[model samples]
Target chain A: MRHRLKDVAERAGVSVKTVSNVVNGYVHVRPDTRARVEEAIAELNYRPNLSARNLRKGRTGVIALAVPELDIPYFAELARHVVTAAGVHGWTVLVDQTGGGPEQERVAASGIGDHMIDGLIFSPLALTADDLTGLDGIPMVLLGERVDHGPADHVAVDNVAAAREVTAHLIGLGRRRIAAIGAQRTPEGASARLRLEGYRAALAAAGIGYDESLVAPASAWHRADGAAAMRQLLASGARPDAVFCFNDTLALGALRALHEARLRVPEDVAVAGFDDIEDGRFSVPTLSTVSPDKEAIARLAVELLAGRLAGERAAPARELSAPYRLELRESTEGPADA
Target chain B: MRHRLKDVAERAGVSVKTVSNVVNGYVHVRPDTRARVEEAIAELNYRPNLSARNLRKGRTGVIALAVPELDIPYFAELARHVVTAAGVHGWTVLVDQTGGGPEQERVAASGIGDHMIDGLIFSPLALTADDLTGLDGIPMVLLGERVDHGPADHVAVDNVAAAREVTAHLIGLGRRRIAAIGAQRTPEGASARLRLEGYRAALAAAGIGYDESLVAPASAWHRADGAAAMRQLLASGARPDAVFCFNDTLALGALRALHEARLRVPEDVAVAGFDDIEDGRFSVPTLSTVSPDKEAIARLAVELLAGRLAGERAAPARELSAPYRLELRESTEGPADA
Candidate 1:
């Protein structure tokens, strides 16, 4: 599965130095020769060892933090924590946005273009276990939802438990009709699937039958998607007394829609969300949500990566769990008689 | 004023190879020699030629983006655009947060640890002209407020004009007692000063005397500071009919304070902000802001940096201006008869 430079050269019918020139972006290679070499690289799934080339000479003391997107406040806040944590190790972090797509996520996981980083801390959105099969020579620590076992160290919050707790909090408020936003219809929605399962478990525990109509699916977890999903649920006349969004951004969007519809928060509908981003703290009604220990996640991820980079290839992969707590705010605190 | 490796060696009373080892982070260098070399490096401000070392061998196809903080939505959004722009040039962007401090900004400007990047697009907060004097070998494009002339290519919106337009809009809404938030009382506050000047010019043009009490200073442009500044203004009994925030986050924070005080937006106080971030779009009553062409800024900055890296160093540094427009949402659309 591991293809070397010589293998690429043999397949392209060119010298190793020619393939090297193409990989290194040297302009002297002929167009046809470069095309042939690139085709061979694609067919063989060859990842050039440029990252290792720098590592072998000396420590670059630079690590890469690859996230789904920087525009998401959660990722932005998480990136800040990671940068601060990495600074303590005397390592500079280079932040890369993978765009949460398979192609970009795969490129980040493969360490394709980051030839200067000593290791990578990657939070993948669509990369699968099969895609991670031959991660040849990079020290990687995974963050967020688990894709598979035995590949890399992972640091994440207990999403299922946190979701269950949030749903239970809504149920305890005597709300029989509850809505769940941010359900994904794809297999790559591992995080969404887990949260949905927790919501179902909470409803079943409360002896309430699950209503399919109350579960809204979102293609992406952005404010626009959340608003559209909320509008769709309302148009369907589900009339849910409480809404539990998968993240804070969705909750904020829902709040905007409710305000537009002239519905009072907590009095008519109690709304809750996960991932207590900073915006939630200052939102009009002050959103209630789950607050994962982002600092712990960042620190543990960097520590695990440092261990792997310090020649701990023989050590077993670690799956570290970060702590989280529910933040009960004005948005979720309904009247006792409701 | 440029110091070389030989200069550092001579100052440290050591060989150039030893200085090189110390600069390259080799662990074999003795503690005393390393300390002496570090002292000499600091005393002479010797920036190692590591970034150039990789550039001479071959293009690394990587550029670094140094911003103050990623937690700020504006910078995060700008970084996303820059990454997308760099991808078009077949270059990967390495994002670095300079923390808006002199030491960190100086380090980022000097290109000390980013040896793999061929260029840097830096938006410095506290760095001054003297700090940028001996930027010897790195190719850099400056963003945000102008720090010095003839040093680097600059890309930014006309901060003063944008601020004036926003203030004039508030004035046109028949708001006589207009307050300005985010006035910095520091020499490093170039952006803030420009915005303040624009606000003053707008007031002067309207024949309205500038009230010193209406200008509130925020140490930092975060939501917390905005909320605090608004609170201080309210407590000081400066009942302004309008508030113009320097940025969107501060405006969002001021909105929170207004809501807590039960003041209906536009009816009680018309609010305006700069930087049309996504959060402002979804905020209740929706914010009226100045929308700078961020895409154009990103593209122009990357193009300028690419040009410099392509051996256009002798070319005169150019200053490019992006366009902007006023976004008038419900927050600024007060009752016409009032």
Candidate 2:
């Protein structure tokens, strides 16, 4: 009484390929077609047990996502969105915490791939172009980078443009001396370098000299790092009119540090940040930052991975730069006059 | 030559079963023995393709997690923690969003037992004892409620005690008129009902009459629903000096509604929430809430599922409620003296 794929396809009145694609969660299939195919399978009581299917197809119906750490709220939120999007394609996600170490990134990449995940969605903090060479033959979608070491797709926010716009917003408010806080160098295509370049561009446009002392170094992207960096900048006696943090976590830390130092926000010093996380909206004084469309990025990443899994071939890799919007809030614009 | 399980056992000087346990990520193995086996694996360059092994064992290296929704910060954070914990065991997670529907809950249970996943960690918002008829023979770890219809391990917060303590805190603050906000009834074993019972207990201890008019009903546990419910409660002219929301999301909406009505927090009406989310910490004036150890819950849930997958009948239909801590902050207590 076992049902076969052919029987399901015949009952659904579709081509066998369509039924196959539907069962595999291929995104190209129309919703109605998928519904019909699913109905047919249900009527036939046919189940494609992944363990049994793996024997013949060598596809485990799993994908791996390697991010820095889920403990970080940003990554945690991103992982949630990604997992939700992956579920639409009926794919399971195996998460890996790289802890932003080069060695760990390599290990996660190899370990998950060796475990037979069909593809990888990697947001590597420490892996460089050279390190990506070993990732060949694995279908991957790179997040936070533009490197193309393998035949992989890339999805990222344009860090340079987003940073430039955020800096310009601060400059537009008549802030002359602006300090930038982030990593000075990193193995993962230099987020700090790109952000710094954007900061310089904004300063140059405003006819201000880029002060080397204004650039603060952070070992990692966290609130504590941001707090420490801000402390160092304040202790150096260079009183910048404004501070532009790389991310919301660091910005929150910077805000805490500024609060402890008894400096008034937007009055004594304007503050700006990137990545408008949910926390930013609810901070004591709502944060002004560049808002990236996380939902859109997640949806596109999952769609791209699903396409590859469904035998969509060798298309030119995509680089989706999520558009950023500047949200003017209480922190940078001062409290609303009641 | 390919390294076999026996080869790894010989190299690590362990029994074949011990080597197998190490490979399968069983939790009982000694740390030193596991380390030795891992070192041996590295030295031998052993690559155990999980897909190939799954074919032989009839087990997919994946588990399903059914939750109400990820849009809520609590569930989103929980999913992130769960996925990270499951990854330590080399297991992939297939997330199912039930949207708090009874039908969806039933479908999730059926989907897991249909061999789409090797096990399940379910946080059911719907489906009662009556609907649990067909869920036998599935390895599951129930979350939120202790369903008596099946034999499964459960991990949840002490909702009754948490609610009571939170209410008592508000009462101790000298707020006489207190109200509760949550679902009145649901098929998911009445989480809101239990919390309300705790609220009643606190009120009885304080000699305050339980005003039925003050309790607000939400169709679902969402911010918009809370906002609407609060608006209705305010329109009814039943003013409570303090309010206890079932969760942070609802409390956030209540805060917004109160602000719009020109009622300042902890000045005219105090507010307390459950689930100490990151947003709660950053909320304007910060939220006072019942904080659960989400990391500990996630670890326990994954460990329990791992134990069941290993065919260990260690416990039957167990329910373990983690302790909840009350975080005193500006929402219920006035802002720190400026």
Candidate 3:
């Protein structure tokens, strides 16, 4: 049964007005009556209605992080940093998993939870720039899987540049015939396109034409997908001297395939990955990969969202790319160093 | 500036009563007046105040997942399952990182966000059963650390039984002088104690006297702490033929230390860890671990919270334990198999 103001008033032996005054923190109530009303409220577990007051105040002190999913290590780690950053700014985080689908992404962007959230950090995977026309007035910042931007704030690393840098690193290690792993036939907002472009740019810079046969297609960018792609590449008789996986998850999978095949990394077949996940550090031969500053991206995105929520508008929209670095580890560090 | 209802009413050229009726979906408003009010609302980007409605209805349609932090892989994975399970029950999750401290855990449990959340799924690292006394009125489910039940739902795996099973497996593998890694002096709950007890039970069952020197203490459960503890165990010259880490993170770190020390696993020493995290599956030499049914726990906890929200009073408190299994892989597969 729901407890009402009348019930609390009856319990306190006072009128409903007295209970209301006490619950609302009004100073005009008599001291003994106030104490009685407080006792009654506590006994009833009656919470003060904060809706009208919150509506008047116009801030909920809660922000939301809408990611593809929490199971993915990259997004999981990114969410950790985002939650921490939001906490520093006195905001809590509501986490939503959109399953990386266009329909789910639209629902997340439709302000369904706007009543309790001050802003949103949306990372759309399946939605394109054209699909985001309805997100006009939401105070949201975009992360990961770069799309053509709407009027919202966006933060991401330069994927093309990072891929090029990692490819160059492989080239500098005297690795030609580098097989491109994790190539998706259908692109999501130019992410795969930019990475592929960077890989091609590096190959062109080294005077090696892109080999269509060496480009292994993957069903997904997970570890299993990387492993499958490597196996497919091996079966096709490409015999690439090196493999450049799209992400660390794929690279880790490739490393497992290499380990299984008794092929020594860097010595026989050099390998590299993108996104320096924690697993990359703990792999057998620690992974050599690109380390995009994830924490910096989270901080910048949260700060940008906070500013927009506070009605600070320097520009109608802002595009900030987080810095990236090529991290050298044992995976690509050849036998000479050992 | 905050958009006021008066501004919306003025823009719609209607009395505040008509605008309020339109906003509240009251049928007393005419069709043209309703359309005009909605247009003004769209112009103002006005969100219906859910706080007042939620207060009256006594349901927020939101739940909270209060974990220590999402950086840890086990917690991250567990949270993923929880969010999915909650979604199946039509509840959204508001994730809060309690920083693994008693103070923060208390705040998370004290109904601080009760006005906006229907319940909480808390994974406390520092709070004990005694500390959770006053959280009776709130709908919550405790995960991981086994604090005494305080009228809240709880779900966990039997840590003691699983630990014993793994230790017995190590003993069955023809290894003696088994050293324990990742023992915490200050236990969060029966989790560490039960695991340690299980290890001791296995040794006792095998008629091996408890050797204090073989037990290594880790201050925290991270990989670094495990590696440091392993190094300390090595420096002490215990010379154990096998090691059982409290969790996979510690085991991975211990594996790194064992690798650096030139110990070929299962040949020089065998290693086993708890919690079959994803990284454990793809480690250089695949890790052997105890796989707790995380999804089952998530489903049960979410169902329990939903039932509580709907006022199903079949039980005031429920305690459930998910099943676990021992997963064997290359880490302890031995040279004979090789």
- iRMSD in angstroms, per model: 1.1, 4.9, 1.8
Off by over 4 Å in 2: A1-66, A71-117, A146-150, A220-237, A256-264, A335-338, B1-66, B76-118, B129-133, B146-149, B219-236, B256-264, B335-338
Name the candidate that leads on DockQ.
Answer: 1
Candidate 1 off by > 4 Å: A1-57, A112-115, A146-150, A334-338, B1-57, B112-114, B146-150, B334-338
Of the two candidates 2 and 3, the one with more favorable TM-score, higher being better, is 3
Best-to-worst order by DockQ is: 1, 3, 2
Q: What's the lDDT for candidate 3?
A: 0.77
Fraction of native Cα-Cα interface contacts (under 8 Å, chains A and B) also present in model 1:
0.72
Q: Can you list the residue pairs that collide in candidate 3?
A: none
Error of 1 at B95 (Å): 1.0
Provide the clash count, candidate 1.
0
- Two-way lDDT contest, 1 vs 2, winner: 1
What TM-score does model 3 achieve against the real structure? Answer: 0.81
RMSD of candidates 1 onward, in order: 18.2, 7.1, 14.9
lDDT of 3 at B105: 79
lDDT of 3 at A59: 64
Predicted model with the maximum lDDT: 1
Per-residue alpha-carbon lDDT of model 2 for A153-252, expressed as tens digits?
7788888888888899999999988999885664553777788888899899889998989889887777778888888899999898799998887888
